[model samples]
Target: MTQPPPPPPNQPPDPQGGFGAPTPQQPEPGYGYPQQQQQQQQPTEPGYGYPQGAPPVPQPPVPPQQPPYGYPTQPQQPQQPQQYGYPAQPQQPQPYGGYQQPQQPPYGYPTQPQQPPYGYPTQPQQPYGGYQQPALTPSAPGGGKLSAQLQIVIAAVVAVAVIIGVGIWYAGSGGDGKDDEAKGTGGTTQGATGGGGNGAGGIGGGGKEKPPANTQAKMAFQVPQPKVPDVTDVSGSWITDKAYVKPGVNSIVAYDLDKGTPLWTLPLTGQVCGASRHVSADNKVPILFEATKRVAPRYYQQCTEIGLVDLNTGKLVWSTSITGGSAGDQKARFSEVTLSGTTVAAGGTDGGAAFDLANGNPRWKPQVNDENCYDMGYGGGAGLVAVRKCGPYSSQYVLVQNLNPTTGAPVSQYKMPTGVKYASVVSTKPLVVAADVGETAGDGSGISDFFSLDEKTGKLKAKITADADQYAARCRSTRVEACSQALVGNGRLYVPTEEHEGSSGEYGDETNEVIAFDLTTGRTVPEKADAGDKYTLVPLRMDGGNLIAYKAPPYDKGGQIVSIDGGTMKSTVLLENPADKSVRDAETSFSLNGAELAYEGGRFFLSETLVSKAREGDDRNYLIVSFAAGH
Candidate 1:
């Protein structure tokens, strides 16, 4: 689906206007004290009117009077002298004319009515050599006045202590409160969105370290074998820490990836031809296209039905029938189904139809007369794409159209280059990369060319003459397809190449090379080595900044899965296929349907098919093996 435009840049307002400006910093809470009241100034001494007269007489010295209230006064002599080695007690002060005398202590050692020395409060005398109590001011009842610098220091200490305590509590409770809540509600640590703009519910493409090569493979889960007429297709999609699998033609099951327990299952009455998971901002559901036949006495017919079901509950949210006709009418059935945003589309020979995933109501269905329009599949997050042929079998011109994901209408259309009957879409966003397929050369070699198109206007951006013959020769003896698969990632299109071997047909040789083309410049990237002899690595999918690949040597058996550093091209084996015979056979069958490696929540998954032979008969079983990273 067309991705929503990015939010506008957040720009701070101009200082001149003062609009959207940041608020002035306020004093930290609990660190600031109320402004000190201004001290009152004493009235200026009255000017002497007789300044010019004779000097005043000198005054006599007088004994000091009792200090004012709240101020410490000098200590008075004891009432009586004490003997040697014995402490002397000072006499109590007389009550002031207006103020009440301080209360006496109940713990004996009579309260000293006499004021102690300045900066020191009266306290009971300590024993000889004992620890002495520190002197304290008696300016105020609650606390004494402190200097401004001292107050700042005290505030800083208190602020630091509070911060440390909060940090400890946060660490103990979990780093992020939202993440803790998600975990409690069964959310995974891996990113919800998958690579290739595939959407949210699939296996996450974010960086997930693979398991060690020596780690053992264990079955994480398996669905009970369901009896069906035939197993048309088997596929799996990741939903949080669980996997949703269409294990059989008439059954879809969800299993917990870690515990291997079945969560739910929905049995079907017809064969599912196409299935995909729609992942939006708030919801994820499986959309299935099934063809069911009804055998009535006079009417034997089949109809195509599209449905949406909850992933966790297996409840049918909504379903609608698309086409109803004779069972043998091929043109009346939808051959493929895909999801984009809130729209689910199914394409077939006549044309294609779309329905709103939210409510299962028909959105639109474009009609193309006498031409087969097939769904080319999702262009990542760009939108849905389809190819329409103009002429009959003898001669035809291929037309490519970018369909509006919301309305099922063509946004742009362009005629492909002459002589190419089909194009394989590699990406659909900022740039569209496709490989045009043409007839094989007279020398029995394949012919293919890569093209880049502008996503907005469907105009040709660039073209690269692919060396299909060289690639075919390299994989001639291997089970891997000779046709190069184009993978776009990190602003470059990776094109398979056999440049190292050239045109040589050396026996037992394998190809492990890919030429990267800069998307913006349309030039080959020479900084990266196009080939390596250390391992037979075939790029599968992009995992964050790294490229996940499969070691292709042991094609008939379980092989090593490695991750290639995107910048250095260094290969590290992440997982190895089990040495068991059943696993080997299963890997062979699994490889027939492209690569089976998937990463989700720091774990890797490989879906395999196991065949069990028994006295009664042989049964085919499907099992998904999970390999946790660092295990």
Candidate 2:
């Protein structure tokens, strides 16, 4: 690697958006669809948010500005467990094109929900093209009616809705979710297995589970939301054959996959800050949490504790913290964590560290001797990778390193192109990285182009330039391991295109497609996964060499899980959720881009990474919602 010109003041790479700043609120779900009485709808793309062959849709008057998304100075006293809010989430990722940027409140502050955003049209806007639904029926015949397969599915949904009555899905009936209700994790593997996308970014893997005879699902169980004085971060979640593990308050709780009840509760001292996206072979994961709970004026604590949790047995097999040079003997803090090979690594503005995944012994501590350079962060899973920044802050460049997990040494290193402010490790094994060169990604997604590199030799393979407005992938500005919404597998990168008008321009028909890019050639693949109309498809993870995606529900339909074959891109619907209003309401409550979602053994799990204090009229805010189908 070239060592460029030298000698200037050194500073860490800075990305846009200061930590803890308030972001805007989101549009509401469930708008009504306008009907066309006489004429047939035709495919049109002349303009966005417009119906074909109809007069321009009237835009509503802009609403009042919403408050920021952090907690107030005076926190609200939460109500009893039985009286939480239901589905009316105040702050979420914006609809249409908002990127799911990572936003954490400053140390002690919780997010305070602001007033509602601008009112949407009474009739929801339709967004899509006339692409045929992949893995299912062909496109709509003439009018805007749904496909034959969808019609049948709707009928089946109604039948099941009558049988189940949406009664089981609501939070009111579920237990209050007290800590005592937990069935302790036996400290054993429990025959569990890691369930996640490939080494890339995704949370769940359903490749091994066979499609049920009736793919439609019924409500399995839901974990009710707990009261927080303010917005709290509980960002980690994982799935195994036996239990679905989620971090709550300062504890990690594993709940039975079939029953919403807790399997075991592993308590922690501080609140959970970060979780490993990749799970170990034996169902273990590394986590970063605070050293102590927030109190009085000292609102927040450094995310100083790094620990490995045995997911199967609910045991904190090992927990420890280390001190850095002048950065302080006061315990090093980390912004993110990952697991690779036999190592667990943590990275942040405070340098980086690694530990043996098996026993939690320190592999290395943060080094501050090199004032001109620092380890910005590391990404792991399939392999361990790091982004090291050096040179003066003015002309600093980054080296993306493929590391030897055991020694914390770079096996190979690639120098990033000049003028790159920050870089994120999308996947370590495939050696995919993303950056907003010249800060061109104005959408706050913190990505502009993807660099496919040679991990073994530290060479450039391909550079896939992504247009922020055109692509919907996200990576938090300075967190090296936080890129998401983009799936990498089968030597291809899958991302959703922006939503557009669908065939028969009608209200509420927005749609999009998942297109693939060859990592080897940096060229677009011919096959695409279309979300049909009215529904938007987001690629979740890869399953069995296929793409697992979530189909966002339209005004009257429920979400569907479809598998797109890697070779042909032909999609197959694996689970079709009920469109019944109550069920749809609960399912949509978990925002599409912001929610933590996964599927295992035919069970679909939706979870929240953060929660806040409920206002006076809040109903039953649920923390986790589960849907399952089987023989």
Best by lDDT: 2
Clashing pairs in 1: none
Q: Relative to the unseen true structure, what is the Cα RMSD of model 2?
A: 21.8
Residue 460 in candidate 2 has what lDDT? 56
> Please, what are the lDDT tens digits per residue for candidate 2 over residues 271-376?
9988999998889899998988877554577888999999989999999997663356677778889998898888766667788887888787665543345667
Candidate 2: regions farther than 4 A off? 1-209
lDDT of 1 by residue, 430-526 (tens): 4443432333222222233445555455544444444433332111100011222455666556544432321223333333464455443233433
lDDT of 2: 0.62
Superposed Cα deviation of residue 531, candidate 2 (Å): 0.6
Report how far off residue 616 is in candidate 2 (Å): 2.5
Candidate 2 weakest lDDT stretch, 10 residues: 177-186
Per-candidate clash tally: 0, 23
